[model samples]
Target chain A: MHVPVLKQGDYLIASVQSVLSDADLVQLRDDLAERVGQFRSRGVIIDVTVLDVIDSFATRTLRAVAHMLKLRGAETVIVGIQPDVAFAMVQLGLTLEGVGTALDLEEGLAYLDRLARKPVKHGK
Target chain B: MENNEACVSINSAADIVTARQKGRALALELGFDGSDLTLIATAISEVARNIVNHAKSGEIVVSPMNHSNKRGILVVARDEGPGIKDIAKAMQYGYSTNKGLGVGLPGAKWLMDEFDIESKVGKGTTVTMKKWLH
Candidate 1:
């Protein structure tokens, strides 16, 4: 019911370990907060490849995770969403517009790295 | 493939997959290819799930498109339960009033050619979706 994979480094990386259930989704939200509560990072990447379905509760948690991380000066990225899952989302009219997404874990990490390296623009 | 086919019924979430399978079979028998049949089935499943999660109970109607191409499938799902009071807010990417990924309606809209949703507070919700077979 609970299997999480998180990357270690300047960024916090987490992945859902199994089928997402109503309870697991809630736990993930809490775990995300507890894990990144003290870390000073640029972003967090959550791999969702193993998840076959995303229900309303799960969506809410994802949004919460993003919000919590943002408050800590970090962004959230969701990766590896399956086609059926993606289709289901659209049918239900779900969108992750503000959150970052990648095709897989590698690309997600790269995206985070890219965001981390972006130079801040300021008036000279 | 005759256009004189229609089936409507109300079922629970446990029956959703079987209902979708039946719908896809009906579409295939009516000359829709595998891909398009799958699309219709998937859309039906998503919307039906919405009925179960949000409305609690509903009916699903599947009919053939009555157009010149004769290559379209129409699905209408209606639920006589707590209707969606805020369509615009529910349509947002991360705005889910229930416990889900909030991707169902938007994703279903993407799978088909046309999609429409109508609902009222304390009345019910109706979702009409159509997919053209190529």
Candidate 2:
């Protein structure tokens, strides 16, 4: 499945519309990381609205991808998770902890924008 | 009694996607609504992924069923791989032997109305799940 990752300003928006396999997911992770570097993006919005199923592996991969992007100085937001998919994920205990989530792509982009506006504090 | 039974083989990640799509199509044909269809499809994906990740090969059977005044769909995923040594432990949340999230089995169970598991050590594992058309 082809996943289009488009750069808008300083944020990268990836709309995932395919039923991804393990290899495809791995490739996406690598691809997104590379894009983040090449584009010098400060945030990413991953849209999964079209997916009917978000299995355990996919959930984990998303979480891992978000974590990786965070390490690369980019904030990540997941949007468009269907209600049934959310129910199954929670029931199965795949809470996708520590990952930022929004209701839709618009909200995701806005959330990232808000994050970008926050003043950076040096050192904890 | 099994009727309108369909089966799909699982050997790779691509097969998992196919099995879930087939499950969703079968459930849709059985008059399952959107939520029910997603639930069934997600359940199928979990079990089929297990076959690819742990078993290396397996089969998923989807069938329409009727009992009393109720109608539903049945899904059976069977894999001949290294069987689960501790079924109970494996069913617990966040318990994964393969360094995974350990939610496949238990999560699948929660997605369906009825769930059953059968496995033998050093043999294989079989999971049967059903979702009623409500």
Candidate 3:
């Protein structure tokens, strides 16, 4: 069972738990992407804290979420990445690239707040 | 010899984690980077998952090797079960007989420098993978 920890505001929080397999990682990304479209103005914070391992599939899914949110005029920040897990990700040569990574829920919210204020840079 | 002295076994998922931890430790002890250790762990996890789902019981052997001018980590995944019939097809990504996403053996082979698969229809399968550190 995989649950995504999400934050709506500084204090408002919600958990989206799903039984995910390798394929479901992709599904979850799509689901989150759709959610971003519906709640772009509110911004979004996704808690991937429960994830201990980041494989190619998971990385791709996360990348998709990041792109989708960006398209919907919103910003997404990932939080609670464990150290050993980060080390594993580094070893895999996996890159978050455009996605933001935070230390915890508080940090993630803070990161999102900061992004909300920054002027959008158009890739023209 | 330093090569023969390195060995370990994993039966369950917990054992898989322990085995991978030990494998990474060995990789570090032999001067490999943490990145290599991650790939090794992923590869081992895939094989161990296969053991649990298919073989039900198997043993993994991790040994150090001096291959050419670089140090290589040799992993032998042995299992006693219904062996693989088509080695070529099995090596293809997304070609799992079981309902896997099909990124286990093929992915492991891609991550390593050398991969060899030997199996008999009714016997078992032995996969040997070696990752060379430069």
Candidate 4:
């Protein structure tokens, strides 16, 4: 099953709608990285509203994806995390510390836009 | 211990997803709220994934239970594979044998109300957990 990743201007939006296995997530990571390079996108917003559960593996995969995007000059914002998923994440102590998160897709896009407008920080 | 139980085999990643789905549906039928349902499902996913990644194969059984004046759900995941040598270390956060995040066992334990594990090296392992309705 292919996850549709739509490109909007300088941002890419990918919505996760199905139960994703480790292999699927690995595929997504590769796909997103390739797409970001091809589109020269500056930001990505991953929507996970349709996902009922986000296990430790999935959380780690998201963090990895975000790190990979950052290395490629693209910022990633995860959006639409359900409240229960959030609760479980906290309970499990899988904080996803380095990943950015937003309440919804609109908010996530806004966040990316803000980041784009900000002046890049020099070596610090 | 109610007779309404659902069981699924876990041999691959897809089977882990199936187990979580069935577990979630059962939790919903037992009147678990949205948050509780998600918690239960996530807990199931953690253990089921352990089976697929660590044990290589296993089975998950979810059942409804009634005790004293409380109702709850029970999940039992068992595998006949290389059992954990140090069950204590396996239960520690960030202690994985396969370079994983190592949150599967401990995280599942925290998500549910009760958690138990029995394992013997070169034999097998079984995890039993329960979450009572609130």
Worst ten-residue run, lDDT, model 2 chain A? A115-124
TM-score of each: 0.55, 0.93, 0.60, 0.94
Interface RMSD of candidate 4, in Å, is 0.9
What DockQ do you compute for every candidate structure? 0.15, 0.68, 0.12, 0.76
* Deviating ranges (above 4 Å) for candidate 3: A1-107, A110-124, B1-6
| Candidate with best TM-score | 4
lDDT, residue B45, candidate 1? 68
Q: How does candidate 4 score on lDDT?
A: 0.91
For model 2, how does the per-residue alpha-carbon lDDT over A42-99 read when each residue is reduced to its tens digit?
Answer: 9999999988888889899999999999999999999999998887677666777888
- What docking grade does candidate 4 earn? medium
> Which candidate do you rate higher for TM-score, 2 or 3?
2
Provide fnat values for all models in the order shown. Answer: 0.28, 0.83, 0.07, 0.89
| lDDT of candidates 1 onward, in order | 0.72, 0.88, 0.67, 0.91
Q: Candidate 1 or 3, higher DockQ?
A: 1
Residues A1-124, candidate 4, lDDT per residue (tens digit)?
4568999988999988787877888888999999999998999999999888899999999999999999999999999998888998998898778888999999998999888664455796
Which should have the higher TM-score, number 2 or number 4?
Answer: 4
> Model 1 misses residue B17 by how many Å?
8.9
Per-residue lDDT tens digits for candidate 2, residues B31-91, read: 9987788788888988998888889999999999888999999999998999889899988
The residue-level lDDT of candidate 3 at B128 comes to: 88
Backbone clash total, candidate 4: 0
Q: Which pairs clash in model 3?
A: none
Model 1 alpha-carbon drift over 4 Å, by segment = A1-3, A7-11, A17-24, A38-42, A50-61, A81-95, A114-124, B1-46, B49-54, B59-76, B83-111, B114-126
Q: Worst lDDT window (10 residues) for model 1 chain B?
A: B1-10
